[model samples]
Target: MDRQLKPNPPKRKTSMLSYWTLRYFLILCIGFTLIAAGALYWIRSTSIEKSMKTAELLGLEIAEKVTGPGNRLLIPPDIDMLVDKRIKLFNTDNYFCIMVLDNNHHLMYSRPKMTQDDVRYHLSDDLNAPRNKNYAGVTVNITDSNETLGKVWVMQSKKSLTFSTETFVIVVLLLAALILCGWFTIYWLSRKLSKPIRQVAHAAEQIRIGNYEVNLDIDTKEQEMNELVSSFRDMSIRLKQLEEWRALSLAGVTHELKTPVTSIKGLVMAVRDDIVSPQEGKEFLDIALKESQRMERMVADLLDYNAMSAGSVAVRHERIDLHLLVREIIYQWRITCEDKMPEIELEASTGTQYAIGDALRVQQIIVNLLNNGLQAMSDEQTPAFRIRLQAEGEHLSIDVRDYGTGIAPEDQPKIFERFYRGELKKRRTRGLGLGLTYSRLLAEAQDGELFLASSSPEGSIFTLRLPLWTPPDQHKREQTYRSPVNA
Candidate 1:
């Protein structure tokens, strides 16, 4: 039994939940990160450009105010008042500086008065710094229609941008929620799918340990899944049945061979020891020889069955007139049976019954059926049966129906099981019950089948179906089917 087992498979101990959820988690996180990075990039670029544009416009406005219609400088007091108010208002939610320089490179006006070094030190190019720290300067030329009067420099920094925007916040929350929901759903589905498979694996383990009584009643809401469970359950049941049959078959084989060996030993020893007179000894020797022959037949049946199982027995396939074959087989069997041969009414078809099969195997199957029917009526004074031959679909069916008390209802289904002898057969016969099982195997080996067609108290019919032969050119070939008796 241990030798029958397949090699143990290598293991990767990972739960399906973790395998799927973690992998998807990584994928979703990567996707979210890329999207967030892209959105932030767009927002930062837009904010930097917007702040620069606003500063450029402010520089133009300041230059326009600092100049008169003829492009001359404004009065210092007027410039002071205008510059102070404008700078204060612009810097309310912003950080910027305003400066006006003359055409001779002299600083004419500076808001909050800073030197060149102070201006340069306060300005920065770091785009991601705080809005007040990341300052840039935009210089707009102060000019009339013909000549440049002065320049106005507007220093401004970018507005702050963060993930705290209301729309972006809402989208992040929604994305997080969707990712969590999707992961949870995937986890749930993985559990549902893996649960049955895990159960089946466990059941297989139980079977490996020779326990076939595990009944899994899982109701997975999938058609193929339910079928898988159902098939496993059925296979376990069949394995258990076959196991039981195997034990019974062993016991039956042992008991049957033991009886003949014991009888032969006793009879032979009695004659050798002169326990009986010459005439009685001769008769005893005859009985011993018959018993030995019976044992040989039993052993032969066992050998033949084993050879067939090992695929060492080859069967020939050829076209033969089944009608003629059956007639000759019955004739040869009747010669052996002599006076006790039962009446067999052969009801054959009028037309030829050509079949593609092994002739020897066919003879064996028909002979086994005849012997089974004959032995079934061991108690009857006049045993009888009928052989009905007919064309059924694409096969020729030979039904060996017996008129004796039919097979016991309980035993009918198992008659073809190896070593399964009925109660009546057990009482009347002294051989291993392999005839029907072997005959069925032979029938199947030749692209044929044997089955009990019907059974009742009054009679039983055993049928053998043989494949009909057709010529290679897709037409029926004719053979004159002659009965051996008529011929």
Candidate 2:
């Protein structure tokens, strides 16, 4: 049975604007709810306090009007009429009782004809008293010449402080306005941030599909946004360049490796078939061997280059004499390839200058440099390139100056990139372009650097900077060698 794999369900997502607006909305709802509760509490408590104070004043005024010059009570009908008119002055909802008491606290008169218990209820001062359980009351004494004649008592239900319709509606409208403003602010700011992110994501999709030419027309004054756009654009441009070099390297490496293999095969077949004399066959076999060696060198170069990037290639950190090492490298190179050799000069600074690096890797870097400088110039051009070594501060600087046809301004910047072949190298070389890139990686692994100090029509100066060997560096190397990790 052929079983098929099922596709996974897509994950859910929320947009930035909606996400932020909803969060802000929730926060605003909670905040506004608390604010509304507090406002209602304050309004109710204030209304009750102010209403009680006004009620006390009204009672005092009514008592003044009803009593005569000696604080004597008015006629019954007149007292009832004055009390009724004064009752109308209060709030529409307040239900109150007014009564009078003589000097001995005996009830003399009261509206609604209250009993003795009612008078006592209204006169009680305790908060939990019979009337205090549901009503708010105030009592005032009427006196003249320091003699208490009577008392005015006022009482009203506490329900009069309930919220009115107009106040409720006004408070609700204000809270709504604040929430609306908060939602709009969050949405506006979120959209501003999200638009650029969306554009970058779209460009990223373009890159995923192998389209490196991405045009971003976004403009933002924010510092972080500017940095993002700039870095992305730079990365896209670099990828495009790397893609071009990848294609060229694939073609070049394939052809360069295939030719030697094909040549060796044909040469071997010719010998086996007895197509030539034994003497000529021996010469052909030697040529084939050299060709095979060339092929082996190219393959090794590729493998070592990759291993260096993976940190799998073991590199020895040692103190090496630059002057002696440079001399040995040039001597071996001259002995191997003596044709078209120029009169080369070595300029060494005073003293035995030592630098910290891998001796074999240093030889590799110097040989590569010499090959590049020598191949750059022909007999017609100035045969003037020098190898100079000197100590600069705590570092050793070795400069290889070539007065050949100088590197082009455009091509100089990319010379150290892997598999990147400049115009000169493309025309004159027959292997992968990894010499400069590998040299730089090797230098950096030893806490050093390799760079082009200068390149123009006059010539190019390639400088290798390595740290000066000190007593501390020697101790560190010894420790590293003795580490158990090596075992």
Candidate 3:
């Protein structure tokens, strides 16, 4: 039995608006709730304290008025009339529960109905200063001269405290409604702001999936996002250009490979069919081998070009004698030029010519320069090439000069481009146009540089400069090899 594979689920996208809205809403709600609750609690505590103090002051005033008249042992007939009038005045506010007593603590008067406990006890006892009490009160003592007359007391009910708490709750509920309304408005605004961000994000996702044609409709009124969208559009255009260039490079490589391979195959078949004599057959075979070598060099140069382009070439530096290295390169090139009969010249400034660099890569750079010099001098009368070495300060310089048809100013700028051959030169060379480009790259990798010094009707000179490495002990007697010693 075979099991079918299941497709992966699509990723769920989150909205930036909803995410930030919920986050801010919760924070606001919690913050407002805490602030409102704390404020309500404090207000309730202060209001209760203020009300108690007001009641105490009122009671004290009533006591002063009643006891100020005289130190009478018994109540006068007009005393009841006075008490009735005072009760009517005090009870108008309706918040205070007032009661009066005589010298023996007997009930003298009360605005509302007073219980026996209310008249018999002092106002201090009713103040409810302890737990498990029913009411809170404040007392004012009544006295005539030095004699104690009675006491006047005022009390507030527990029901009134409960009412204050209920009012606070209602206020908090109303405030919460207002806060929620504001939060919703902020949420809507956030959604409006995040809409453009969402569009940009979706477009980015499409681009990530190789859909380069994704267009963004973001508002240009927002400066930052507009700039971002503009940059992204430019990047997409660049990516398309790069893709086209990649296709062109692949086609060029295939065409380049076909030419050499076709030549080799035709030459091999000609020899096999005996279409050519044995001596001519050897010549065809040699041509085939030369084509093969061309293909190999093309492949190697391509690889090197890729490495240089990617910045992956590692340079290993060591102390090298520039005089010795240049001599070896010229010696090898002299053997190669024997049959071609090119005039070669070598020049050097006297000094201890030492440099720190990769010797093999440096030698390759010289070889490439020499090859270019030879190719440039193909039609010259004497076919001459010159190599010059000089030492100045801490640098060693080598110049390769050729008396050939010089490079034009227009082609000079792009001469070192990979696979770039100008219309002025031979169409078919031993290697691709990567030689100069690779040599320049190798020179740069070794902390040296290759630049065209002059390219005019007289001749062209390519200069190579490397940083001279001087050992601590050899600072003196450095002028011996100025222009090649007598040996």
In angstroms, the error of model 2 at 420 is 1.6
Please give the lDDT score at residue 218 for candidate 3: 64
TM-score, per-candidate, Cα-based: 0.78, 0.81, 0.72
Candidate maximizing TM-score: 2
lDDT of 3 at 347: 86
Candidate 1 vs. true structure, TM-score: 0.78
Task: Determine which window of 10 residues in candidate 3 has minimal summed lDDT.
Answer: 478-487
Give a tens-digit lDDT track for model 2, residues 1-487. 9889889988889877788888988999999989998998899889788877876887787667656665576535577776667667665453666677766767777766888776666655432232565777677777666767777777667766546668889999999998888888878888899999889989999999999989988889999998998899899898998798788778878888998899999999999999989999999999999989978887887888999999997877777767777777777777766666655678997766778777778778877887778777756864556888988999998899888877888988889987767777667655667888989998898889999999887778999999888766544663221212123
Where is model 1 more than 4 Å wrong at Cα?
1-12, 53-70, 73-113, 120-180, 265-285, 471-487
lDDT of 3 at 264: 98
> Judged by lDDT against the true structure, how good is candidate 3?
0.74
Which ranking of candidates, highest lDDT first?
1, 2, 3
lDDT of each: 0.79, 0.78, 0.74
List runs of model 2 lying over 4 Å from the truth: 1-11, 68-72, 75-132, 142-151, 262-288, 339-342, 379-385, 402-404, 454-459, 470-487
lDDT score for candidate 1 against the true structure: 0.79
lDDT tens readout by residue for model 1, 1-487: 4668788898877877678879988887788778877877787777667666766777787777777766687734676676657656644343556667677645677776777655435543331122344555577888877679987877654443222356578768877887788778877888898889889889999999998889697998899999999999999999999988888889889999999899989998999999999999999999999999999999999998888878888986777799889888888888888878678889986977788787778888988888877777747547787888898889989999887667988998888888889888888877788888899889999889999998887778999999987765536544444443454
